[model samples]
Target: MATTLAQARSVLADAGAFGFPVDVSRRSDPVVGTRDSSRPEPFATLPRESAAIAGEVLAGELRSSTKSDGSGEYEAMQLLRRPVARATAAATLGAIDDDARNEVADAALDWVDALGPVIAAPAPPYRWSRARRQEDAARKSLEGRIEALGDPTPARTATMLAAGTQVPIAAGAWLLVALAERPELQERLAAGEVEPIWVVWEVLRLTPPTWATARVARRSLDLAGVRIPEGGVVVVSPLLLGRLPNLVPGGDGNPHQQLARLEVERWRDPHVRPGAWLPFGLGASACPGRSVGLAQLVALTKWATSASLHLAATPSTDQTRGIFPRPARIAVVRVEGGNT
Candidate 1:
């Protein structure tokens, strides 16, 4: 049978009991252990690394734009759409042949052209500064709100945002997009066969883009009979759990449907079980920008749906995990007169 939300919470709590204590303050002394060493270390330096990579990528693309050749221009356009490739381009450019380097440069250039205007227009002074002033402004605003409420706890803003906005916005946006794209789902929604909120829950539950998350074990634990030593690290994923036969109907219950129900419940009443439905992570380590990020996502979805957008014939699907699961390319085009 499908695990009820209560049952899932129990399982998660049991796992957490066997897991390591989370240090929200970031002041805890680092501890070393065998199982912990096997997992990917937290990329504490990611913010800096991302800034540097973005800078190099933009510079490389801009340089490519100077070329007069049509092929170079086309390559630049391609690169402009795939900003993530810039880092790889920068790393491999020197070792590759002229043709390969040019290709990389062109793609980088294209990506820069497409996305640069958006970045540059927002804060001209911060151009190339890498300070991310807009995000800082939002964070400060959120912090002030927390302070006014007399809650100075670390990550309080992040927690509020995750529960109040991020999850809801992501859930809504993803579902709306799915409905607009999938005719059967759209018909179902139109016919009032499924709750709109449930649609969002189902979409996220079934297609969570994030593959896994790592956690440290506070003490020794057993997983499916495998003994894990204390201070060991464990990676947990709903993707794997959802696929377990015993968790689904016919075997047990449909994990996807159960997760969907859980999401719907959480969205409707976050306080009903705080931190249990943590696609954004639980407790102190939850993402800080989740609110604004979800807002952006929701806005984009609203625009797409209103414009009657359709995905490109060959949209890209390569996704990588960050703070959350996200699509690599969610291309869509407005269908003329399709908006109702």
Candidate 2:
């Protein structure tokens, strides 16, 4: 395990020396989502127009949810389900009809759900097991939806949509939870006292959806002072790195206590650069749709700040599928000026 930030950075930076321990040849084409024999990067950085579309979709979803629900109560994960899925789908499925995009979005959600058991299993399930079959079915369904849109790389597109959707959904929920928990901070953001991006960074620092990632050493090598044999897995935890005093603001208050708190103002200082902890992994394997994800979060933060929201129930941590706020129930106390 990469215990220090430097070690983690080294492990991630040298993608050649370290790789994910997966047999690409054994994986199904739809799940692998490679372009061809060479397996070039299938997911690209989202274009600005696509990012804007994602932001619009997210904002509209939040507004619709708030207006349609009489009680003003929302389960963060469930509420964000369609919005994040559809937002990512709309962004990635270029120039598709609204209905086709929506279908792809729903299919992506189903695929993600189906993937839960496969990912959570301690070891890969049997190929013919119910979980694997269901997952395969869901993936094929998503791929088919993309194919219907005449997308040349339907499998790749479906994989991209699913991969992009899940993380942002959790991140968006944490953003809402953070805002709801600190009304003062929310007010400051709404009043434009603080930049929304800082809040997004803070949420990502504290509760990054992909809190930890693993890389396997392709060859026996020294990592920091430690030596490892071939295929040794090195895990990097962003959650741990985010709390380091050097990476984030913690000197003002007790360093230990302050680092853990959600302090958006901490980012006001121009010197301390954000994302030092690598909320999104670094190097060639870094998240491809990070731009769209950030746009979605910032947009959500803006919409959240416009309204008064309070936690209906305390959120519990769920590490099964990355760290996220489960049962993140919130009550919209009041709607303010307008949506962002």
Candidate 3:
């Protein structure tokens, strides 16, 4: 069934009437949490102090993936992982040092990897099972590193880092893929005529990292003309709703085409708001790290546009662990006129 912007917003707004779609019974699971308390705070607004730090860190990370001579091929998604991970760690755990940031970033990825089989498993594993053991080890390693920070509480830090690190990686990768395929946009960007921030929003609109979020019905009710029994699953797809003409600015062309392809200029209109499509999310469960995520993406976009991007192969989506470009390899033929 097609979901509209109004319906998606309505479903997400009532968090009380709807609950998380993930299994929340397992207290030991590193990924899923049952309570609102587990959701960290103050990250929704990225402080100016941290924004500069994050932007610099993100730019450096992007620069590092280039060849020693300053030009080379890179796995776009793979290249983005570390920088995004480290940037998110820096943004979420401000007290940590560079070395600790590296440590916790690596650990956050491990925890995310270990969570894959855990979620795909027929059921939650035994506490001592291999998946559980790997997940636990990664979680502990991350916790130990972040616990040294002493603020935001170690528990909040861990959750924030995990959620904050993973999604941005996927989003950044998608952004790069879009840029690589559209050379004219890349040229415009290199010429300093484009707003990198708008590129970030457009990318999110076409391919949001968290494409869909779920809610469980608390009690039987009819919603958006569908009847839901108690404990029923009510799904809201940002990807689907994003394609709706009403939410995205059509200008004079077919609005659905705007949904299918990246329109970097669609958001340039002053009257159009940046997030009508529900990329970060809505209501109490909406991601708090959104501001920080956007900052990191903007920084990445700035770095990417200045480089000559040549795709090794057309990148495809790997739905295995959320959406990231499958085999995300790309060649930076040159870094702004530098020879490889």
Candidate 4:
């Protein structure tokens, strides 16, 4: 419930103190919830290979979107879904052909949509409930596709798509939203006066899609002066911690003002680390596709800066779908005589 960064960091570091939210053992009875130990493969250790694959895929998609006619009103979030999904799908699926890779990409988005309601509902739905049923169907479809490609564990593949493809779509949407609003930053980005990586970091700091993550105590433990018995849950919010002035630099004014104001300059100082707020997270379960996701986003920033996209209307937040823009629609047109 608290937003203390150090305590959150401590819990994430100590695997003995806490385990993942769904790491419990499976119950035999149908009345009980299911357990999942299928963690996605981390891409941090495979930088060179991942960068080449995801970068090429992502760049090509962006180029395609800007083709035929660049002047069109588009829903920014909807526009990003396919490209991001394809990039992530390609990166994770290894040497799959283009057609098979596209099939998996569509399935990933469908599966993520099926999961939305289940995660947002107050309580868990029954196995036969609509949300659960839809989730199962989509999960099966995705898994079946992966199985068709000679992959044994489609379940892990589904998990990878859910975390890697879907979440990054939301994050990329937020990045576009930030760019649409911040004309000053956009100008700097357009002129190549500032680093595109900072735009990604600034957007993440402002509105991290996976705002909060949870961990449950394996046994009795105390955190930040609170004593909890066994099986207690602890929630760490990167969104809240990101607003902390102490963690990120460049907040000479009041706390609220500093946080509300986007500070791309925060990372300009070499002494201050970019990940003190843990946007992707820390320790072992800290998103295996983080580096891959960043590479995609960086390519996105490069494309966005080169294009001209204006927010059609003030984008509304859709908290039901894990903090995404409600109608992430925008007007995208080429900045004539500029880099198309």
For TM-score, the strongest prediction is 2
All-Cα superposition RMSD per candidate? 15.6, 3.4, 3.4, 3.3
lDDT of 2 by residue, 90-169 (tens): 78877778787788889999999988888778877788989889988999998887887788988778778887999998
Give per-residue lDDT, candidate 1, residue 298: 31
Query: How do the residues 186-210 of candidate 3 rate in per-residue lDDT, one tens digit apiece?
Result: 8888787888987988888878777
> lDDT of each prediction vs. the true structure?
0.38, 0.81, 0.75, 0.77
lDDT of 4 by residue, 95-144 (tens): 98899999999998898888877777776667888888988898889999
Candidate 3 ranges with C-alpha deviation above 4 Å: 23-48, 251-253, 336-340
- Candidate 4 yields a Cα-based lDDT of 0.77
Candidate of highest lDDT: 2
Per-model TM against the reference: 0.44, 0.91, 0.89, 0.91
Return model 1's CA RMSD, one decimal. Answer: 15.6
Estimate the lDDT of model 1: 0.38
Q: How far is 268's C-alpha from truth in model 2 (Å)? A: 1.3
List of clashing residue pairs for candidate 2: none
Error of 2 at 292 (Å): 0.3
Which runs of model 1 end up more than 4 angstroms from their true locations?
1-11, 20-141, 149-154, 162-173, 209-211, 250-309, 313-340
Ranking by lDDT: 2, 4, 3, 1
The 10 consecutive residues of candidate 2 with the worst lDDT sum are 25-34
Give the per-residue lDDT of model 1 (tens digit) for 126-150. Answer: 4334334433444454445434444
